[model samples]
Target: MRFKLSTVVLPSVLLLGSACIVEAPGGTSPEQRRAATVTQIPPLSVRNGANLGRKVELVAATVQPGRLTPGERATVTVYFKVLEALEEDYLIFVHVEDVGGRMERMNVDHKPAGGLLPTSQWKPGETVKDEFSIYIPSNESPKALNIWLGLWDPRTDSRLALTNPDQVRNDGRNRILLAQVPVAQ
Candidate 1:
């Protein structure tokens, strides 16, 4: 008895090569295709209320074109209520997550140009509106999106104080609001 390298190698290679060819999953069933393609956006989990100090309370949030074009930009509006005058500097952080796991942050101020404000300066029972526009890159995939809103205390210079070593953990606590927007072709 004798064994040839070519004979064994050739057959094994052919078998493996053929096995690699996979037929596209059946697309005839619309529901099946949708189920396979759809991805659920993660929930925005928050522990503490928006009012960190004593006044500013995030009331509601709304986004225009809740559904966005693949490469288009959209605006998000956040409304807040001031229970008492905000004297110390504070910041509103808006976080956005795309299907590709890319995240971006936008900051808004209590006053249009005054920059981040202190909790004490925000008068009691005052309604404030903050808006931001985010541009979705043309190359992003069409999938579910996640958005989160947070509040932070800024330094005396009205700069966001993000030096906390445990700042990452704050995601769970600072997230006052969450939303999912869709992107389509």
Candidate 2:
């Protein structure tokens, strides 16, 4: 079978081009990107919404299994919807702590999408779904676990403020408590 040169070369070029991360032509700012009309914002799968800094909203968070046990793993998924433009990328932190937030049991912190997608690149109304896994330490006490998360600037270690401070439980440190799960005895 003979393949046309144009067909073979075109596919190769398209694949190579798609791999590149390019800024918007003309250096469009996040505001400009948001100004451009998008048909619709994608619907969120989870409904636990919390506003953060009036820029980003935590659309929802989920912990698999709903209960925790020492020496086991649980998947934590967080959904963030961009409400306004952001000029800098922020790191996401997921912390598993004792019921009273007195002790941290585990911390799963990383850049969104493993550093592939940054907050600065997010457009208004765009939702980002990030997932990470947490392993409970075997030595941890059999108590309830409070799952908390927030976006923070790594350089300054400043966290985004929780806009709806009264809606959910928040530690003075800017950590928004997402859920509480009982540790199986």
Return the top candidate by TM-score: 2
Candidate 2 at residue 132, lDDT? Answer: 66
Clashing pairs in 2: none
Off by over 4 Å in 2: 1-46, 100-105
Compose the digit string of candidate 2's lDDT tens values, residues 137-157.
Answer: 667654566667799998887
Model 1 misses residue 173 by how many Å? Answer: 2.9
Estimate the overall C-alpha local distance difference test score of candidate 2: 0.61
Candidate 2 accuracy as TM-score: 0.71
- Residue by residue across 1-185, what tens digits does model 1's lDDT show? 12111111000000000001112332124442332221222132122124544445555555565466656666555555666665554555555565366544333323221223233444565555555565566665546554555555546433322223132223434453345555665
- TM-score list, all predictions: 0.54, 0.71
Candidate with top lDDT is 2
**Candidate 1 structure, TM-score to reference:** 0.54
Residue 7 of model 2, lDDT score: 12
